[model samples]
Target chain A: MPTTLIGLDGVPYGLITSYAEKGYLPNIASLIARGEIVQMESTIPDVSSTAWSSVITGANPGEHGVFGFFDIDRQTGRLCFPQFSDIHVSPFWEGKKAAAINIPQTYPARIENGLMVSGFVSPTVEKAVSPAGWLEKVRELDYRIDVDSSLAQESMEKFLDDLYAVLDSRMRLFRETRDAEKWDIYYFVFTGTDRINHFLFDAWDDESSEYHKPFVDYYRKVDECVGEILSTLKPEEKIYIHSDHGFCPLEKEFYVNRWLVEKGYLEFATDSPALITDMSPSSKAFSLDPGRIYINAKDRFPNGSVGTGDREKIKAEITEKIMRLESDSVCPVARVADGCEVFWGPVSSRGPDLVFLGRRGIDIKSLVAVDGLFGKRIFRGMHTQDDAFLIAGQKENLPSPFHVSRIASLVV
Target chain B: MEYLDYLENKSIYVIRESYARFKNMALLWSMGKDSTTLLHLCMKAFMGKIPFPVIHIDTGFKFPEMYEFRDRTARRLGLDLIVAENRLAKYRGMGPNKAGASKLECCNALKTESLQQIVAKLKIQSLLVGIRRDEHGIRAKERYFSARDESFKWNYTDQTAEPWDYYRSLERDGTHFRVHPILHMTEADIWRYISREKLEVIDLYFAKGGKRYRSIGCAPCCEPVESSASTIYEIILEIESSKTAERAGRAQDKEDAYTMQKLRSLGYM
Candidate 1:
């Protein structure tokens, strides 16, 4: 029997379960009743690229090798976005007859037998799909990989409209593809949940909020689409539903690179340093978005200063210090793990030396030239490591200590 | 980024945290792939030297090859190795082959008791274990830092929540913590790391006449699986596509669904 996986990106366990229980998502509620649902853990950095890579590879960052959206190019000492090819392991459906649609971090999709349409980070529809012939059809269907999330900053109404339009296009693509192709495994991810959550998550449960109805209404429409999709599944076939990571209310943005400068761990040669490469040779450490810290080791970076022997001490000292970081009685960092311990594989040696897991309400970011230790952002919500959910068709087969890395095994 | 570096950094962090938190801490070395990789991590964390002692529970039934590998590796790594053995059990004729002893009973007497003796002797407050969640179902529930009470009984029912790396380092009186730095790593990861770091392991892991040991323990309790993977690269390749569990060759876990849990709760590493 063919297995179908419907990914509702960024939908948290509490939000979906509560919504399903309260009659806002009847289709999902019925699905939950027929299966099992639980809180699933995301990757350490808890970003879309890392979590989705884990989902496809069925391995931790150590095995799959993608730590975050961005990584320091060891040879150049320059930061670069890790693309689909950066993932080390063979995707779960490497040899299987499969159809993957709108899955994030899968830009420049590769498929042999069936179809594929990459999700986020995909610059153009022509380059995102396999079976190149599908390009014209995808464009004709008005398919969009992701809504311009930045639009929410200027106009919430236009952003909501974009979300609905993108979701509608996604449903159209899903319906058209399901009818056009038959495969052993079929996976389609709806990224609208994430786009809406990032902007309007605060509206949740607050009936008085201006955008509350639009927020809930978006999910209601999502429920109707989910029902339409489920109606296509065979009774004997399995299905899996999950999110890459959870969403949380963002209270403040912690400028990590700026914090490093204030703490004297980092030094920028230029006052208006827009890139980490502008860091002085004496700089000890730097940070990346969603809290990844890398030591400017002499062996790795061209302008490195920290010696190999001193790297550990500095990392431990920073880890201890970052754990105590606070602002207005709120500890920004929940934990700071030494990166080496969390990842292990052939390519792991180039990962960050330290990774910070932020506390709820704090979004850890790395804008190199930011002025202060903390700032507010246009984004109202952020990603969380825990609370990302998985609703499995066959609970008996779900991997224990449930994690996103093990999600692919349930289907492939 | 390389996944190994991430795991190495995290392991190093956990190691440093344990060292900073506890007055007396030690790492349990089994000469197995997991523990040996952990020893590498410990050494890397401390900058080419482990600040704490490395304890090995010599169960007497371990393979001669393992003993050789252990001694050679300890000396090579300059480890302050302390071999813990339950001589009293050996003297009393308690063994896996003994008429009245089950494999589990023998393990408790030989391995667990030996470990307990060493812990008491050293008054160690924290122990670094190389247990991974992917090893067995029971281990999947373990936190990075887990506690055992006065009698060394693991309260598996009430584990402290370890969200991210914010591990609970505190313990009550008469309790000690078991720190797992590699709890998130998988079997495939261990082999892949072994390849990446080029760490030495016992030759028993390699295939002999189409048989290879996937996991190493007591000589009698551990069986070699049918395979032709003689090199570390081959092992990684084997692990990536292998359908069998990592511990499928070990005997104790085969006794029942809860055998490992029972053993672990009773202080077995």
Candidate 2:
């Protein structure tokens, strides 16, 4: 079967379901009627890069060895962002001929049984696509692989312009390239939803807010792209519309490492280095973005004092402390998943000791030298679990919280 | 009169100003089209003989033709050239192809640290580079004239804004400024300038067999794109008509979301 999967990053079932219910997203509404709509569970850290890697390869974070967006190199103790080459297992469609575009973290564009055009986080458009000349074709369609994100943070008008521009060019390129090539499977992702949601999500429901129009306007553009992709679907072809993860709004930053310091777990001598990885040798624990807590075990960090045998005990203590620690202004940390259970793979040891899940309104930072526990965020949106939407054409019954890797099966 | 002419005039003006502002100023020549073109602009700005020397940080992994071009061009132009290499690091087995390190680490060990070493030793108050805003996302965030601390770290978040070409060149005694003479030029404008000036481009740029180098870096770290445009006119047509990023073939930028930003922060051009 020639399946088409369109990934809408950071969109939840509630927004799509409600909007589709009201006729705002007609294609999605129709897909729900004829297909299965289920909420999906993204990877534990729930970062876009790792989530998309899981979606590409049917393996979990442990199996794939991609734990988070950025990982700490166990040997060098350096903060390293994982790339396409870092993927441990062969991608799900490794052998099959496929066409994938605008998928994040698939940089240095992989050349396998088909074409791949890596999107955001890709260094250059030339290296962003495979088979060489397809890059020219993508550019010819006026596609912008990476949006000028500074505009989104600085100016709303420019942000909307850039959002629509990317959508239009992406739609044109996807359609043009889909017909231009023949493949067993064609996959595309619309990231503007995630970008727009981050900046204008608070104004999404507020009609009086200045950002309300741009919010709905961007969604309408996404809806139009989905509709266009749907309208061109072959009679025998079935499309899978889904999101990597769900979106939530965050008002304040939760400084996890600072909290760890407050609890006397992590220590620093001279705070010359600004990052968590630069902590002093005696430091027992540290944190990374999106609330990942790592115990600086002897073997893990260069000069870590905590031993491997004591890993479990330290993790347990940190988990309890993190769960109990909360600020009045910040949303409480609801659930903490042990890193051992959360991450499993050859490189899983490099992952954090605990993966902290914040309440809806909370977000985590990896700051080691923060001024205080409470800090306002420049951007408003964040990632949430159990909010990802997956609509498949198969008649088989699916679980409400379908796994992200399950979509990898439909790609082939 | 043309876009290229406007860009060239702006670059010439910027180059002259940097020469006037700092007694210790040098242009970084990477032996690539952009830097080679910048060299030609320097020759034009200084009336056939650049007053200051040129610096080229050799990572020891460059294409053989690059070294040839560097020596030949310097000799022919009667220019003072200083070739720098981190031989100690390379001898100790530090390379882009080395295992256990990410792309950016290799770049820092070979490029950024090497440049910083030379800059501090030479005490160059300002270094002129041929960086354009459209090259990469990180480059887009830069000003025409950027400053770096004693450690060669660029404070990207707290960068000062420039109005009417007023570059804030003042910095602490140990600190230095990076004067970008071609920050406003586009990739197309660069090709146009090269074509108009009749500058000699490296042979790697012209297509041979089936591939051509778009952005030249170290041999192990750089890859070539598929292009049939062997001549200057064909290259110009290929570039102006296509939207592929020029530095896409360069491998260092793929390390992460902020690899280039980190490299620039650590003092890599």
Candidate 3:
């Protein structure tokens, strides 16, 4: 049977259940009644870049070797965004007749069997699609990879309108593609969910907020899209709906590198350090975005002091010390693990030495130029490891807990 | 890297990572072929010197040769050995023959509980377990870094994904992780590694009267399989051709199909 997999980035299980129960999402409610929604665990350093890779490959980071949204060069200690090419393993659709539309980290798309369209990071629609001829059709449909996220900071009305516009064009593209092509698997993703969550998560529960109604309407439209897609599928066809990760209302942004500085674990050569590569000779450790800490081992980094023998001692000391850190009488640092413990495989040595998971509502960052240990930025929502939901097409009693790594099995 | 080099590097990376992550961590040394291989990897990872204590959960029912090998290896490697035994349980004479007790109960009271007590006393945040997925069906479901609650209950129901080497080493209150460095290595890989590295193992693994223990545990529970493999080379050759399960000779595994799952869910390393 042909399979259809739908991805709604950053949609939480609780939100779907609650909204469906409240009659705000009748389509999703029918799926819930017909089958069931199970909470799925996302990848560590939970982000689209890592989680989507897992979903496509059906393999863990140790096997696929893509650790985060950004990876550090082992020799240079310079930061670089990891692309789909950086992924070590071929996706499940390697030899299948599949159409993967708008999946993140898949820029400069390639599909040997069927159609391919890259996601948000893709520069333009022209460059995002393979088989170059699809470009003209995509442009004709006004197909946009993502909503202009910066518009939220400028004007909420324009941002909301753009969100609806992009989602509308996405649905149109889905219809145009699905009806025109014959494939064994059709994978479509809505990145607008994550964008709306990042800027308007607080508006979701707060009825008094101006954007609350618009937020609910955005999801209501998604439900309509899902219903429409289901209507086109044959009775014997399979369907699976899931998200990369869940979302939570952001409380405070924890600047991890600043905290490291306060604890004397990191030192910057300049008072206004711009990046991790600017660390001074005395610097023992440094962190990248989303709380990935790497030790500046003398054997590895150019300006380093901590030797290979001292990595364990230093990591343990940091783990203990980081647990004691408290902000507003609450511990934001949830868990800390050494690099090898979190990652393995050939390229794992290029990964961070320690992975720090923040508690819910606390967004962690590793920007070296932050002024304080904690602060609020433009984001009103944060990514969470738990609470992502999956509604399997041919539901059965799964032998193990659901995770993004196993999501590929649902369709491919 | 070569296949053996790959396995060695992965194991060394895990060993180093766990040591760095958990300051109060220790390696579980069962004096078995797998754990002894793990011990060698630990020394290699830490630059010819093991930085942490190596624990041996003594059930007091081990073979004499196993004990001899343990002491000899510990002294030779200069390892900080901790012989963790439930002296109270041993003193109370708990064994398979205990009244109304099944082999499972004896194992829980002795092996599992002994490991639990040592972990609690030492406040170990992480424990290096030498388990391979190829060894059991349930172990095949385990993560490289698996977590257990304060009461030492393995939450096999809700394991997080480990994609591209990023393991879910989330720190929760009163939760400890079981780091499995060799989980990906197969039985054949282990023997091949042993042969290549020339690592020493207990003599029991070699054929004794055309019989050898494929997997070792407590003396009463473990049995030898019919094999004429007298050296590491022969063992490697045997592993390539042998279709028998590795734990077939262990009575504990034969108790029931789900017995290991049940034991593991209750934190049996």
lDDT of each: 0.81, 0.77, 0.80
Model 2: DockQ vs. true structure: 0.03
Off by over 4 Å in 2: A269-273, A329-331, B1-269
Candidate 3 — which residues are off by over 4 angstroms?
A: A124-126, A302-304, A399-401, B1-4, B7-269
lDDT tens digits, residue span A51-73, model 2: 89889877777656776656676
Q: What's the i-RMS for candidate 3 in angstroms?
A: 21.4
Of the candidates numbered 2 and 3, which has the greater DockQ value?
A: 2
Docking quality tier of model 3: incorrect
**Model 1's chain B TM-score?**
0.88
Residue pairs clashing in model 2 are: A62-A344
Model 1 lDDT per residue over A9-64, tens place? 99998899889999999988888888889889899889888899989878778767
Chain A TM-score values, per prediction: 0.96, 0.94, 0.95
Query: How far in Å is the alpha carbon of A64 misplaced in model 2?
Result: 0.7
DockQ of each: 0.03, 0.03, 0.02
Task: Give the share of true interchain contacts found in each model.
Answer: 0.05, 0.05, 0.02
